[model samples]
Target: MCPVQLDGIGPLARFSRRSFLRYSAAASVVASVPILTEAHLARAQRNTLPKNIPPGAVRIDANENPLGPCSGACSTISGLIPEGGRYDFDLTEKLEKTFCEMEGFKPGYVMAYAGSSEPLHYTVLAFTSKDRPYVTADPGYEAGMYAAKVNGAKVLMVPLTKDYAHDVKAMVAADPNAGVFYICNPNNPTGTITKYEDIEYAVANKPKGSVVLIDEAYIHFSDASPSFDLVKADKDVIILRTFSKLYGMAGVRCGLAIGRPDLLAKLQLYGMNPLPIMAVAAATTSLQVQELVPQRKKINADIRQETFEWLAASNYKFTPSQTNCFMLDTGRSGKEVLAAMQKKNVYIGRVWPSWPTYVRITVGSHTDMEKFRAAYTDVMNSSTAGLEPMPLPRRLRETPFTHLS
Candidate 1:
């Protein structure tokens, strides 16, 4: 596979004075509406778990990094506990500055949030509307779809190509007035990548006034190139980065939105809460560790490859994933397998409606995968006679974005 280049994208010049003035005017009304975030989405995903989880359960759900924050990040966060009382907004600015300098982007083009989900929601709220539909791949990350629901925008779920890559051309032609085209590179659920040229094609051919939202949450785990070059060229693109996956900071909650200043300003209209101090400190220190990304990438890749090999030897079908997760096809109903695995204390990922027979599996530590394999094999051979799949979440219908327990 051709690797996506990762070299620094050259610095982008600041937006015009007029654009900054306009953004300043719009920033006044901090988002009064409560928006759905990734935490809420995670809760929705967790609805699949049993009422009571026993101790020592092998949990490979949620695609979380088993290796927690690096030593430097832990120390930096620990050292900042005393000053937690004060809202060190300057630390956020410094964090933003550190990331901007590293990525060759102007400081004004980036904004730090608790996690990328905030900006993801804000982007849909800012760009999409009832008439201007939201376009995304079916079985892609569902966070944006929920955000679109909040905005009362119609969602167009284009099916991924036969190869499991985003059908960029179909997405472009899905709706002529699409407000936002969301792409999750190394897509969630299915860890397959849509090519860089296809992304460029979407940028070039997408409807006018529509922005292409690229979620690179799992980019570090994949060999694909980052989309910073589009932002550097002043395109209508916003790229989201997070410390959750590879950096092992999901609970710490630090992420960023990279785009043109004018584009980022639209997100500011949603909200501007100060970031968590510990998250900022940890993220800053993590960025400074130059060797952190490659080292962790190898760890995840090796484990994932080992698991894939086992699945092949056992004649189990799965996507050729390049990241921390992949979709596995259970010969029977995926929900039955999920429930049976849960009984064995080996909880896996949820099932997507588009592919009822396929369940997403997060690549965990080698030991975790070994247990998963044991549980999975036993479940496959045993009869699922009385097993019942977890009930579909009805709370979403009751109230969109309501936290599901």
Candidate 2:
């Protein structure tokens, strides 16, 4: 799609230096609120897990990398255990420097966090407000919406294009006073990519003072170009990266946010806690492994393709995903399929309200996926009697912005 001209925007165009300062000050106060505490964050993560997940269940949910950290990273973490007592070792600085050099970013263009989630939340809190709305793809990552609600910002959910990519033009037109445009490459749940050109269009034509937040959490799994170059060009964009996916450090919890120094500084007003010593050490070493990304990318792609072939042979419809997860359409209710799979000890993913009949399936190891194929076929062939579709909660069904004013 062609990029549209976004000239003649009024108050949004006047997003001056004074306006930034004022927004940042207000965001800082919101960040200090009790809801953003460390305990709350930890609790949220725990809640994503299914209760009483049985041991040995084929877990293809959560889009987690089955392969843990690389050998080099594991060794580094083991070596750094003794040094954990010291809070101010230069390991975190080393990680930032290494990432900057690797991505050709200038000094201070990147900041490390526990995971990409923290920076993602901070970006929404910093840029969005009641007047300035948060615009995101309808079935996109839900975390940003929650953060926007915390800041009392209007939430605009733009539907994806026919190809399952974010409709950049529609999103730009959704809200003239948009503060943050969140585009998740290889979007969660769907595991599909919004084209890089579309991202550029959104960046260039978005409402003035709006920041384009690209979540590249699954970028390594796909062949799409990284958005880091936009940061190098000093565009009003923030790119989030994490060691959790390809590097397999989800539990280790190391991630980075790349953007202009001024933009990143605004996030700091919310919170910039110290990095864990072991996670820093592991992440630094992981970056040094020359062949780590390509090797794991091949492994994941091959397994995902194999699973796709199986679904096709079984005459089931599925989304073509370049990442480690894909969506499968169950002929019956998705919740019923999920429950049947669980009965057979095969745990898959949650369903998005936008497509209640389709359930997400994370690409697991070869053996785990084989188990999934067996369990899924059995569930689909069985009777769906007495199985009711679970409706989404009212809070999740309605946009948070509607309740405001």
lDDT of each: 0.82, 0.80
Q: Which residue runs of candidate 2 sit more than 4 Å off their true CA positions?
A: 1-50, 387-405
The global Cα lDDT (0 to 1) of model 1 is: 0.82
lDDT string for model 1 (38-146, tens) is 3454345443455444689886778889898999999999999999998998899889899889889865888898989888988988899888989889778887886
Worst 10 residues of 2 by lDDT: 1-10
Specify the highest-TM-score model's number.
1
- Hey, what RMSD does candidate 2 come out at? 7.5
lDDT for residue 230 in candidate 2, whole number 0-100? 87
Model 2 / residue 301 / CA error / Å? 0.6
Over 1-405, each residue of candidate 2 has an lDDT whose tens digit, in order, gives 001111322332555566567656766666553333222322232212445457888877777888999999999988878888887647888899898898798988989988888889889988998899998887777877877876788888888788889889998888789999999997876789888898999999998898999999999999877887789999999999999888999889989999998888777656646789899889989999989989999999999999999899989999889998888999777777876777788878777667778888889999999999999988888976665434444444455542111
Q: How many backbone clashes does candidate 2 have?
A: 0
lDDT of 2: 0.80
Candidate 1, superposed: residue stretches over 4 Å from native? 1-53, 397-405
